[model samples]
Target: MGGTRVRTRYGRFGGALAAVVAVLATLAPVSPPAHAAPAPSVAPDPFFTYAGSTPLRELAPGTVLKTRTLPYRVAGVPLPLRVVQIVFRTTDQQGRAVAGVTSVIKPLTGTTSRVISYQSFYDSLDPEHGPSRAIAGSTAPGAMAAHVETVLMAAFLLRGYAIVMADTEGPTADFAAGPEYGRVTLDSIRAALRTPATGIAPAAKVGLVGYSGGAIATNWAAVLAPSYAPDVDRRLVGAAEGGVLVRPAANLRYVDGSRIWAGVIPMAVVGVARGFGIDLMPYLSDEGRRIYARLEKAPIIEVLGAYPGLTWADLTQPAYADPASIPAFVRTVNQLNLGTRPNPTVPMFIGQGTGGQLEGTRGDRPGLGKGDGVMLAGDVRSLARKYCAGGVDVVHREYPLSHFTSVPLWLPDAIAWLGARFAGRPAPDNCASIPAGNPLTPLAPAR
Candidate 1:
């Protein structure tokens, strides 16, 4: 009976998803023949760099550095989308001023009074893989994820909501650096509202939405907005996210030896090392070094299933077998933990999934129980509960699905939740009934 119900829900969701894809198909240009020429260079555009003599620190966060209007294209096919791309000033994980890029897509007909800051889950270690590059027609291997996400953006755009797609990974493509993702997202909103030509009014209300890699940016942006960008915080109606990563340390453990998600271990190590400017070369084994070199610029798609049954022991020296033994890693993951951050002031809708076995991941792993293959369900529940305890309105839902399979189910509900926030409806909460999960304690250094 349970399986029957699950299938029924997915069957309905499939129909809805098909409708969305149909709309996207109509808007997008037909693909070229199989004999078409190879894709263009995937190099980062020169406009991403700030060449101005004025220092980045001198400019305010979200200060527009450059702007250009272009037709939005997906997978190298031009669509009728008039997108405004902006290079704005934002800070990195180290709080150093840096240039960030965002693409603003206005509805064809609307008041532009409401905006959806849609952070793309373009999880990559290469700057060339950002959404701006994909929207500008780059068909890089990593940019394919961004291209596919256009359907979600189209859903909101069809509802007459302006969409602000920021390169949440920042200019350096710091894959899992949560704080940096948050700041970049907040600054993107600032840049969008400040840019008159984008048609987003200064007083426009904003809502945050994303899943997976995007959830990292969305949740971080929500928590950091009150302090990092109070001006932007006041404009936020709510945040809706799913498959969130609450504690990086916990997630590393959760996916350490999984069949599909194990590769993320190395990719994350590389990302954190790059984001924090930490040199971990001395601690890596020869095998680890090789994996690092190969995945230095890989996208999440490339890493998924590429290294099956990979483990931390395979990547680190015997002495540093435990990730906590590495001081720099301990510090980095602790800093990236969303549980340590302040609760978002606005209402939030959080979704998580538990059924890793569906994705070839074992559910039993000591402290960690079931998860959606990558992100731990307990960690997400704990984070949501913490927010609720802090007097934040939070609606948390757990699904009996894997990370990838849960998206179709979570997205429609998330979109509907955001729609309610925009409609001035009262935000709901399941905080009181949420089950107890893991303790979000910080990682302790190895003695």
Candidate 2:
């Protein structure tokens, strides 16, 4: 609650063998809904746009309700036949039936039957920000994130791997909602493998990859697979996530009063509230309400560096001097903590950036040792160790670069790691090599 805006650090590349190298500064960048093709000759998103009473609620989770052919765009223009969209029935975090979307991108050439799930880190509260809508829809604020993600996805495509992009945040766009993210992702993969029109094998190898916001979905899906989605889990080879936010509560402390990434605090607050039907207004000060209203529909680009030195003291009422002490906030954040969840069944490849001090501010926060601008690096290490202790095969890498700068360094590795998982070879683990990390402490049952 008293986080200070301190200097950031540098990170990325060759973790175990080398120290994190400080990278230079550059602040900066960060859904799905489908619209009709402008080309009069093309049809609308038939399945995604259809108004039918199929009773998605009655169907089992992961059931494919409808299918449609949507334009797979490179930037904003359409590239027909490359991507297929599916509307499926899935369950939410609370076990309620909900409808979700997933996009299946067929490769242009090459011959790998492997299919990979690329969870794009499009962190936003707007429904249009989902990958399903952004991949083919017109360019807007948050939709361009799909375009940026396409660069990494192209590598998998060129390697002949069909990619499945799920709206992990769900149709409701519940940002930071962990269980919902897992449910949507696993179910989307289920929809893709089961949908015959996509031409994917029902038993194809699968892997999950995500960074930053996307990592929330990827990590949860992996941890939830063994129990929540065993059918999908059996086929998953491994999961790779970078710049992961393992503990949301830890992250809140990590980002408070920061320079570039402090803006995410309000964005996360509104998201968790919308997802769980909680009212944060009661504890928030007038400034907090203003920040909430301003960021209600704003995208990641708007959230980055939006607020400089914005502390909880500035947003919440004097009575709520420590937001975590608020019962509802503590309970909800604990539910979102990845460390509280079970270990992943499949092998894992994790990369963390420990250069937040150089990236923006508040890197020297006492409890939040280091970070990658938006996520806490120490928390990532703790989660990785937790997985290893649970008998999971884990490979954790720490990058010595800031959040934005670490992208190029770990993305290619994530791709290659996923590739290895699909190759039928054994994975290497670093369980014995990892050092002890800070405990992932959850709020006590009572204050």
Best-matching candidate per lDDT:
1
User: Clashes in candidate 2: how many?
Assistant: 23
lDDT of 2 by residue, 334-367 (tens): 8988877788889999998888888676677777
Q: Per-prediction TM-score, please?
A: 0.91, 0.88
Q: What is the lDDT of candidate 1?
A: 0.87
Off by over 4 Å in 2: 1-51, 110-112, 445-447
How many clashing residue pairs appear in each of the predictions shown? 0, 23
Clashing pairs in 1: none
* TM-score of model 1 (CA atoms): 0.91
Error of 1 at 355 (Å): 1.1
Give the per-residue lDDT of model 1 (tens digit) for 79-112: 6557899999999998899999999986655358
